[model samples]
Target: MLDATLKTQLKAYLEKVVQPIEIVASLNDSAKSQELQALLQDIVQLSDKITLREQGDAKRAPSFTIQRAGTDIGVTFAGIPMGHEFTSLVLALLQVGGHTIKLDDAVIEQIRNLDGDYEFETFVSLSCHNCPEVVQALNAMSVINPRIKVTTIDGGVFPKEVEDRQIMAVPMMFLNGEHFGQGRTSVEEILSRLDSNAGVRAAAELSKKDVFDVLVIGGGPAGAASSIYAARKGIRTGVLAERFGGQVLDTLAIENFISVKETEGPKFAAALEEHVKAYDVDIMNLQRAVKLIPGKIAEVHTASGAVLKAKTVILSTGARWREINVPGEKEYRNHGVAYCPHCDGPLFKGKRVAVVGGGNSGVEAAIDLAGVVQHVTLIEYGTELRADAVLQRKLRSLPNVQIIMSAQTTEINGDGQKVTSLSYTDRSSGAAHKIDLEGVFVQIGLVPNTEWLKGTIALSRFGEIEIDARGQTSVPGVFAAGDCTTVPFKQIVIAVGAGATAALSAFDHLIRSGDEEPQTTETKQAVAV
Candidate 1:
């Protein structure tokens, strides 16, 4: 089921193959095996350098293997590869066909220096945009380390394993049979975990730093932009983020970000990191600022018990999805309720799901989920949908989508294990109704990440930072941008612009106050990290 454009691209990529890849599929009585076999056949048929063969009986199939140049790569796929995971399959093929690895030298060295036998079992859904990055990283690492085996299981294909593992999200990596962290993980992050003597270091703590020229408190688009801009001005810039990429990682399709026609969230997030890494900024990932001190030299206290000092600070902590805190909502998370359609949509393929709220986010999620899910029931508390007209029109055009306006979600019904249905109250009729579904996606409003700055700065009732035109906060040396601020619109382009403005303002303040000083290139370079 390859499209014309994709087929052409794959053909071009395969033409460079110097070696043959033999796919060994273990058959089973289940239809999934037959479907996977058909897909493998189609892929092998497209290239002369590839071959497919069955290994085990239909009744005893458990695994599949691929061999390149007569050597097992130690790679396996436990289920059908589709959705976002399709990239993983393609990349695995390209690697098996002898394409040179594109990893950094340091990362490759890390992979080659590994000591013990490490088997990584990465659980992923076909729809998770962030899953492929981790999967491909592990797959590439496997190419270098024979002792390292990687098994990729499509969480959607085997629901029993998902429940057994208590998997709440995709890219839930397991190393040596223990749970590793989830979400978009980088190569260096994984190396740290494997090297940890204790349990996988949940997060790397930031060391105490004396002072910084510009300190950014978030890792989303705004924080990344601020750090890059400030560092370009020849100053010490530091970014402390709970998780890099912020809310942008939760987004699915981004057409409104200007210049780029289309891109997924996780892809864009990775690009953002790459772009920021090009500059000399000290990026402290997984560090959450628990407290803030405003003065000529602002101080940030992180949850890891490190105190960071800076001359100027920029807040770009970003926002999170507003949860519908009804009965059974929290308990059923990942069981049958999810907030990100791009991350979890494929897991509910051929199953009915519901979308809560009718804002732009909610409607967009419904439209996105409708393509993969069997049915989408959109529930809005307002009398009419508040989404953009174009999004509303597109959502209405979907045959499997149903709209329920002016209804309040009362309780989330679950089978004590997974979400089974949702109950709501009809505002007009004053009647309660229930909709049976396997998954529920919440896409209401966004709660700004200004809770830590409650008494530190001026915040709106919604918890957004109050910033003037210059992006300056109530505190003189502090500024804010992105969704955490009271900006008119919350968009990627706007956040980038706001970040630039905040950096410029911080530079101006340093110049006017005579706190700026010319430094040697060596000193400047040292602090850039």
Candidate 2:
């Protein structure tokens, strides 16, 4: 299961273990069980503090638990934790064996003080890049509080449970057999959901923060660059984001990021965060800016009732996946309608699926799904595909791929629990058609996450923040960058450059408009709405 190089790395990581641990495997006479046994044996050979035991009768066969020798301070993996989850397995091993987690001390205390028993089950795909974060978070919480138990199940290994639960998305989490959340979630997010007073406490803390010289919204490539550049200027810089990494976290592969031959999205996002953390930037994650009021000291209001003031504000809220907005689409989201093909494609293996859009993302999704799914129907509203010629050619070469041009997706049909088919119309002939499928992957495009900024700042007809070459918006002392702004070519490299320009422009504005009076109570109330 693990190669020589991996074994060497595992051995090295195991050296950090300060306490004895046990790997208890529950297996049957199957090839997968045998493979898991071999893997566990190899792990035990590397560390004298580790031991493995097998039990034949268990609820989930071929599953295993990594626990501290006499305690339940560990996590469970129901499938082979390979691919993107390999790191998660290593972190779990070390954490269970008395290696301290790198989370904030306050966060560790919060987990330890939680009162109730929480059993978390997270369903994930091996190829899913977003699953590791959620798994690792819950695993860490479990280690902090034995009352919290985490079980990570591979959707590919246990198809029955996935279908029974009507799961069509990766990293779908359940609490005590009830749906908790879907997609990327952090430990703080989970805690906030569980604790009623968490939001109020966070809001109070944020309200007491001192005014920042430069406050950046969003945590994508653009916001990261802006924060780093501003912090380098020796000013008080802070970044507030609903979540760091933005759309980059959803991206699967990148080959055109300049100087780097190839890298994954999560990896690139991690590097960006690490680079920014090396500076003096104060990062506030899991916070969304609901309103922005411009003045001498601009006020950014959050959904948690926290109003943050800053000398200059940088808007880099970035963009989100564009929804089809058709009938039954919202009703069936995560029930069979998905936006990420890389994460959810394997769930529909040996089943039919549809990809909506004609652009590079849709064509690429079709091409990728052809290798895993039984069939793929590519639906496009345009007359022709807008992908690169090479990608179009590759998509055309696939035997299981079907291309439908000039077709508008009208509705996503579901059986109340999962998608059963999709409805569309022929744009040229005005003929309605429906294709039976198990999943629908929407890859139309992206819409700027500027809905909250509407009426507060000047936005284009398409809802993008209007900005000049200097990245300055219509509002003074306010700047915008990245996909949320009026920048051409929404690429990571372009966003990074735009972010730097915006930061410098902001500093220049601050120098020119020195000693301006703060907003009065009446002035603040006028725009507070």
Candidate number achieving the greatest TM-score relative to the actual structure: 2
Off by over 4 Å in 2: 515-529
Query: Tens-digit lDDT track for model 2 on 1-529?
Result: 6789999999999999999999999998888888889889999999999999889766787899998999868799998888899899999999999998998998899889999999999999999988998999999999999999899999988899888888889899999888899898889999999887899999999999999989999999999999988876666899999989889988989899899899999889989999999988889888999999999999999999999999999999999999999998999999889999989988999999999998999999999999999999999999999999999999999999999999999999988888999999999999999999999999999999999988999999999999999999999999999999889789999999999999888877877787334446875554232
RMSD value for candidate 2: 5.3
TM-score of each: 0.83, 0.96
How far does residue 288 in candidate 1 sit from its true spot (Å)? 2.3
- The per-model lDDT (C-alpha) reads 0.84, 0.91
Candidate number with greatest lDDT:
2
Stretches of model 1 off by over 4 angstroms after superposition = 1-23, 28-54, 57-63, 67-73, 93-118, 141-148, 155-183, 187-210, 397-400, 427-433, 518-529
Query: What is the model-wide C-alpha lDDT for candidate 1?
Result: 0.84
In candidate 2, residue 178 scores what lDDT?
Answer: 88
The 10-residue segment with the lowest total lDDT in model 1? 197-206
